[model samples]
Target: MIAIVARSENGVIGKDGGLPWRCKGDLQFFKRTTMGRKIVVGRTTFEGLPPLKGREIFVLTRKPDAGFEGATAVSNPADVPADAIVCGGAAIYDLMIPQCDQLLVTTVKKEVEGDTFFNFQWLEGFEPEETIEETDEYSVVSYRRSGPSS
Candidate 1:
């Protein structure tokens, strides 16, 4: 599985339930990487997103029967397909990052205030594979699991 996220220099991924920064390049990169893939997200994250075309969305929620308009509701991370992409709202990332084989992270160049943050320690098992895209505002890096973790 692959996990995709965008974090500020201070590791803030969200602010007031949305992105801390606005970067068109990062949005484009996210769309290109996740198009046509199965995406798993937490209930809160899922609720905040607009309809994503060309992708199957799975929401990790306590109420699996609550029926999301255009997404499937799952109670466990294990229920998500191994080939799916794990998107986040902190809790989901904490649960799914360990199961991911790769990570696509966009690091915003500036620090910003936010209530949600990503743990950098999660990347310890993964090694940088390449810089997929870079600009003055942000850079997207791909990381693959290394050693026994893979």
Candidate 2:
């Protein structure tokens, strides 16, 4: 039940520790999907997050104990919670994407100036199962990991 959640323009997700644009819709979507989920991310992404009160977080870093309250670091992605939400600073998502079961992406309509981008491709068996249309700014797409072929 793993999921990758992100918002981007032309596959680029961030710049200067902030999202390149403002889209309230996409922000809410990101919140809705991730709240209460077990979230796994890197140090930078964790620092970028707004205060999360009760959510469980696992951060990937060389410093296993280098994060705020309610977060612990495990060296690799395999040890994360089953229905983990991989939120990111790009590198975390890249390392964990292959084992991810679902992806929730918000594709911004405009190209952004950024230092990070999502480099993972939607695998062969994944289905573009859900899409939230052509908006004034971006589109929200959910890619689900489909089961074995018929």
Top-scoring candidate (lDDT) = 1
Cα RMSD (angstroms) for every candidate in the order listed: 1.3, 2.8
lDDT of each: 0.88, 0.73
lDDT of 1 by residue, 1-150 (tens): 889999998899987777877788888888888899999998888877877999999999889888898899999777998889988988888888888889899999999999999899879899999998889999989999995543
For 1-150, candidate 2 gives per-residue lDDT tens digits of 555555565677887766777888777777777788788878887887777766788888877756566788887666887777878767776677667777777787778778877675644557888786567877877777787422
Instruction: List candidate 1 segments past 4 Å from native.
Output: none
Off by over 4 Å in 2: 120-125, 146-150
Clashes of 2: 0
